[model samples]
Target chain A: MKIPILRLERILLVSIQVDLTDNDAMQFQSDLVEQVAEIEALGVAIDITALDVVDSYMARVINDTASMVRLLGAESVICGVQPFVALTLVEMGRDLLGADCAFNLGQGLEILRTRIATRGDTRLSEDENV
Target chain B: MRMSELPPAQIPLHETADVVTARRAARELCEQLGFGKADQTRLATAVSELTRNVIQYANHGECVIENRSTATHRCIWVQVRDQGAGIANLEQALTDGYSTSGGLGAGLPGTRRLVDQFHIESTPQGTCITIVLTKPL
Candidate 1:
């Protein structure tokens, strides 16, 4: 399924509510990256709270997506990694999901805001006035 | 290949979606087997990686989950089998950072660490992998 990416100010929000197939994960990656570039988003928060399982493939997709977003000059944070999921991912490998992470969407947005503010002048011309 | 007398919950793997089906079956079986949330996630993640390998390499496979609780031991047995070209390098495949599919190379090795027992057999004709998680009843 194509995951919805919502825009809130200069940040992009994506909540993955279902288990994504390999194809869907890849599609989501491209969609988010393209959208980030298109909107000149300052940050992206990918909330995976609803995901109960994150395998190696999905971990790779999330890691790659985060890197791609950062490559586009946007901050990215992965939020709501469940306790069990976190333990499982670590057991699976070292650095399975190597993106910045938060306990939840709220903390993710806070980190994004702090990061964007710290960077200061990177905001788009349209957002600069605000 | 010691298994329970009870019929295993079998799910056929033909495509990517089957990965999720197999994972859910494993998780549900774990829950029914009375595993805690941590164990449930571990087994589910392990099943997910195994099923994905089946699709990516074998093109087709089947996931079988069974309850193997004995009088003194409680265990969950899972078997994933495929009749496609088997893994060529068992050693390298188990090594971390060794992936042929542009993956993170953590699938096989990572799965081994997640469960209590892991066994794999492969031939040019096909491959079969069995993993087990156990706890005191």
Candidate 2:
């Protein structure tokens, strides 16, 4: 089934509550990317607190999704990774590379806000240079 | 241990749904055995990795979970068996970051780290991996 994506201001929030199959994961990636572009979102927050397990494939997909979001001009943050899932990912040597992480959704949104603000500063500087 | 004696719960690993089923069953068994939440999560994650491997590499397999009691301790024993192409280089396969399927190759070795006991026997005919996690008394 499709995981719901919510829009709050310039941020897109996706909370994965179900154990996603490969197909579900792939579909989520496509949907998130498309939604990010359609709304010109500034950031994406993916919460996986309800997910108990993340295999290698899922880890890769999460990383890829973060990269895809960045490619579409949005910052991405992964939130609510359980302690056991963190340990397993580390041990599996599948670090969620290139993806920013947060302890929970609140922190994730805060981080995204900070990152977007920083990006705004950089763009302002670039405009002044031009 | 003999499989016939254990009356184990069997989980067929054929697809992603089966992986979820195996992990859920493992979590229930851990709960019934009085495992803490962390321990329960560990078992569930390990089961997910092993069962997913069965589906990804072997295309089909089965996981057997049984409760075993010894004079000193009680433990849950799990066996995952697959009839498919066995690993040619067991050492490399067990190493971290060695995945033929573009995975991080952490499934088998990471599973070993999570449990108390681990054993494996693989050949061209099939592969059987067994692990045991004991309940602290």
Candidate 3:
């Protein structure tokens, strides 16, 4: 299934609610990268609160996707990792998720907005109205 | 320690989706066995990694989860079997940062640390891995 990517101003929001297979994960990765480039988004926040399990493969996909977003010139943050999932990943190994993280979507967006504001770059007029 | 057995639940793994199915089933069983939230997540994550390996390397496999609990033991046992090319290097596979599939190489070793017991038997015919989680009741 396609994970919807919503655009607000120059930012992208993606919420993954279902457990994704390997194929689905790859598809989502490519799709998110394509959208980031197509929209020239400034920041991205991926919410995974609904996911109960983040296995090695899934963790790899998310980490790679976040790096891909940064390579495309958009800052990204993974938001709302469940507590148990965090414990499991840490117990398994280190560096499973190397991307930036936050407690929830609201905090994720706050981080994104703050980073984008302090980036020392020109901001779009739409950002001025926010 | 002595333990009594319950009927095991079996899940056939043919594709990626089966990985999710297997983990979910294991998590539900952990819940019924009165496992804590952390143990449940750890078991589910370990199941996901092992089942995904079954599809990635073996192409097909099966996961059997048995609840072996007794008056003084709360235990959940799991076994995964695949009828495909068995792992060639068990030692290397278990070593950290060693992978044949360009992965992070955390599947085997990482799984070992998540549960109380882990064992593996592999040959040219196939591979079978057994893992168990137990708590004193």
Best by DockQ: 1
Ranking by DockQ: 1, 3, 2
Clashing pairs in 2: none
| lDDT string, candidate 2, A11-122, tens digits | 8999999989877999999999999999778899999998887767788889899999999999999999888788766755646444889999999999988898988734
The candidate with the higher TM-score, 1 or 2, is 1
State the lDDT at A75 in candidate 1: 95
- Structure candidate 3, residue pairs in collision: none
Off by over 4 Å in 2: A94-98, A121-130, B1-7
Determine which window of 10 residues in candidate 1 chain B has minimal summed lDDT: B1-10
Docking class of 1: high
Residue-level lDDT tens digits of model 3 in B1-57 = 322434688999999999989999999989888899999999999999999999999
Q: What fraction of the real A-B contacts shows up in model 1?
A: 0.94
Highest lDDT model number: 1
When 2 and 3 are scored with TM-score, the better candidate is 3
**Each prediction's whole-model lDDT (CA):** 0.93, 0.83, 0.92
For residues A14-120, write the lDDT of model 3, one tens digit per residue: 99999898999999999999999998889999999999999889999999999999999989999999999999998898988899999999999999998988896
